[model samples]
Target: MKDSNQEEQRPKTTFSAPVVLPALLGLGALLAFCALYPEQAGRIFPSVQAWVVRQFDWFYTVAVSIFLVFLLLLAVSRFGQIRLGPEDAVPDFTFLSWTAMLFAAGMGIGLMYFGVAEPLQHFLKPPTALGGTPAAAKEALQVTFFHWGFHAWSVYGTMGLVLAYFGFRYNLPLTMRSGLYPILRGRINGPIGHGVDAFALVGTIAGIATTLGYGALQLAAGLHLLTGWNTSTAAFRLGIIVVVVGLAGVSAVSGLDKGVRRLSELNLSLALLLLGFVVITGPTVFLLQALAENVGGYLSSLVDLSLRTFAYEPPREQGWFAGWTILYWAWWISWSPFVGMFIARISRGRTIREFIIGVLLVPTAFNLLWMTAFGNGAIWMDSHVANGALAQTASNVDALLFRFFEYLPATRAASWLAVVLIAIFFVTSADSGAFVVDAIGSRGHPRSPVWQRLFWAMVLGLTAMVLLLSGGLKALQALTLVAALPVTLILLMLCYGLWRGLLADQAHSTQDLAPATSFWSGQHWRRRLEQIVHDSTREDVFRFMQATVLPAMHQVSDELRRRGVLADVQHDLDEGATVRLTIPDPELRDFIYGVRIAHRHLPVFTVQDASEDGRAQVFEPTTFFEDGRQGYDIQYLRMEEVIADILRQYERYRSLSANLRTHLLSRAPGHSEPMS
Candidate 1:
């Protein structure tokens, strides 16, 4: 019974019914479509893709352009210094590991598949420049960089920023609908929230399915290219899907730390080795020169590329833009939920500016280099060695990378390496995507169940296989674009919602800063001064929390309950002995006033020995609020003083919540509290 009570006191997360139903229904539809109606699916998938691309080309173009602009403005805004968690919080992952995960999660597989293909396509038939000319090669690199650069990461960063801010800072569930908390309020736990998450899940499946489609095909191509084994049949592709999905399941079961993170690190190492091989074995100096020029050309043409629509150009060039640039934007937007939430999960304590800048710039630098290495290498060999072979066959984009590798030394080894890299990238993406979608399905429960992870892994694989067998890769691509359409609108709302939430936080922070008056102004000040001067041990802090803090919290809770407000007291019997008073308001998010004996690095001035100087750490009874903001220590305060502090904090929370309230401002005079 004691263990049961402790378990009840501990924090727990669970799913909502409304979210699960719609998500499963969508999942089932995909499964049934692929398994039951294979032939019809094949024909319908391609037509659907073509129609969306044809009709909504302009919408996708405009939506993506705006996403990039919004990210830049948000980063430069006054809220940049705000940490995603508390004001004093630091980053969880270090810079190097974080950067590696960014590459691994965001663009690893796509870059491998399209690194050579996109650039060569642009070179073969430059939309604006003459084909097979010097200008075309430069334009090819520039265009590839543009598609894969700031806009894509900005879309991802915005989604991540919203989620991380709400989850860590505001105590909302870390999911897509939670980003709309400022707008939806508690309704986010309702049908509307379910709908938002459902869309994200569906989009996640489609986007990853598209990537898997590309991966399986590319893997098959590598196999045939290396050993002359014909792996192009539908049966062969299905086998690859089975193998990738099974591997993803193993990784998913292992969880993030041992599974995804380790794979991501390996992916980076293999990627570096392959990149070095290309840079060393292929056109070494030309690739370097092209990388520098590519950066310059990309900057020069950024705006033109961002906002371009072929109002005056020939229909063919317009078609080209719609086919390529718009498609990439839609693809990125579709993938943002999985990628963004995954990014958010890893980036708990990072500041807003650090996150936006690092997420945008780091992957982009690698993206530019990756494109230049493979893209430039392919172009150089086409012109110098293969005599335009790769450029001519750019139509068959999937196999183009393998063909380009044949021009270099150790063609078989390099081709095999490419296969392994794509396979690992495939597993990383699927495993991560499964984990993310499960979180979405379970209404943002981070540790729902292993079965959910495995279930989604199978769903993701099945979705990709179905698309490949039914509509082929084109079908998967089409579904991605179509699914991303609604999320574009959702993302716009989230931008405004994040801004509103930030304004409230900043206002609360400004108002909540108590005047730095003396906390030791009472008749018992001398006694407390002596206590403060000495090092307080864990037992001492716990005694203070239990005797003084806990009783004070119950007094406030009882008073609020008698005043017709819903109030409760909770005690956590951990090392810190945290105690909290929760006051919930249906019109706004709940307010929690909590305090714990948290550790801090001991003061530098107190250390006598040089070796032991910086190592000592001490505990301080620290106050933490619902908004993830930290407050001053109340360890020395009496019960009356602690109760007073709670009231003051509650008043400040009410004031902040009032400013951000859009609806339900009025209450009936005789109406009681929610509990009352």
Candidate 2:
């Protein structure tokens, strides 16, 4: 009886209904909606997708703005004294695992498809403003790296840094709430939190929607390339779905440590082997020269390439930019949140600076190498091969990969290897994506029940099936960027929140100082505080409260002297009777209250009293009593009431200015600070 009673008292560890019910219902609704109104649903999906595309472009603007802000803060912190967190202690995975996972997760299927096609497309219709002749093969390699290099990695790296900081340092949950925790910590349980979470959820759904659509297209393309099958039929879609779901189900069951990691390793090895084959068998001199010259060109053009907006400026080159550069950017931006969160989870214990450099620079370098090796081989063949056989037959990218093998000595064996590599690559991408979706749904922890992951994996596969059934691979490709659009706004919000969090952290560290220290002798503390304030705002009292308070005392003394009053007013003022004024700033009051609230729910600091002039003041004892009671109380409750009332009014105003409010609320700590 006692055992039964104890068991009843124990907390239930079952999955929450909030997490489960919505997912199940969402899946059912999607399936049913598609079934009930197939044509309408298809059109609606794309129509909604158009909104997503616009959002994606908006996100690019936001990302660029945030990136600049981040760099500025970094510069300020260098000059001022600001530190956000203690040194990270997470172990860095060795190069093999890191590269394998990074390559598989970051590029995967996209790389395989675009390796040959992108360069060729550029060769055929080069950007007109760049003054390259049509079929000018020299620019092929340069264009390839331009497309695959730093900008794509920059988006991924930025997202990853946010995820790592929140997950490892803050002891927060792994959902969208945790991702935005730097900005929305206490508000996570509120409507604001719910909206953020929903946005993240939608982003995940959208990414999967795009991926599923593309995966179906690629599967059909691969079949058509290798087996000469007319894969444009409805049956092809069902077959692809079955294969994807079966593979994903197996991988989902195997879990990340075994299935995903092993698959990544295999994919990486296959990719390396393909590169080696090209380097050895293809025109070696031409390939190496192209790589060296293109790399140099890419390095020189990096800044321009990174900032190119492709805004339909030159009417002649508009199609080229829109079809290639803009589309790719949108695709990458859409994938950023998921990829970033996953990278962040894996990147704990690294510094913010290190995380950014590694995620942006290193992976981009690798991508450049990958593209140069594969893209150069195709360019070489197109330029110098016997009869333009490679270019003519290579109608699609998948054919290009295998056709390179046809030039090899062991054609059949090489073709088999290519097939195996393709399968592994798809599995790696699909599984990694599944894990990411699970993480987003579970909110970043590894503790989400296995069934939840499996359910999502199935849903993703089904989405792919629907896309394939509607049209062939071309149809899927057309819709990929469209689905990724809405999530772009979510990413912008994330960036804002991340920046704000970093700034806040810097401020907190700077302002916290012992009371006994003099400003000159406390230069280290002063510098740190100054750095924090400079990083976000000079008026950031949160960063330099102690320093600011000390200076304010001097200002008061100088004002009194100017008024022909005695200089020793500090000694005459009644410390016990001085009142601490409270104002109508919820954020400010929250900060003040936060300082007072203890782990045990008791107030650590309190209002001491009000002055004769009706101003309120708060104080702490210079010396400790036996009971160590701080000399304060809630003497200004009426002031708090008034502040609360004003806060409500401010919220109304905020609602009217939603975009501004979002920008303000989204600013992460190091990005923005409230005025003292």
TM-score of each model, paired residue for residue: 0.74, 0.69
Query: What is the RMSD of candidate 2?
Result: 15.1
Per-residue lDDT for 1-676 in model 2, tens only?
9967865664433333455456556655655666566676667665655554444543554464455445435434541222113453644566567667787888877777777777766666677524224245556667678667766776676567656666665666656666666556687756665555555554555465556566555666666656788987777757766776679778878877788778888888888887787778877887778778878988898666666655646755655655566677777766776777667655655566656556666667777777777776776666666356766755665466666666666766666666676667666666777777777665555556567667777767776665455442333343445644545555666677776776666666567444232222444565546543432222232223233332343454466468774332122122232212111223221111111211112222224432234433223212211122342221122222323423343354445334444445433334545444
Judging by lDDT against the true structure, name the best candidate.
Answer: 1
Give lDDT tens digits, candidate 1, residues 567-590. Answer: 999988674378888987765567
lDDT against the true structure, per candidate, is: 0.83, 0.58
> Candidate 2 lDDT (Cα, whole model)?
0.58
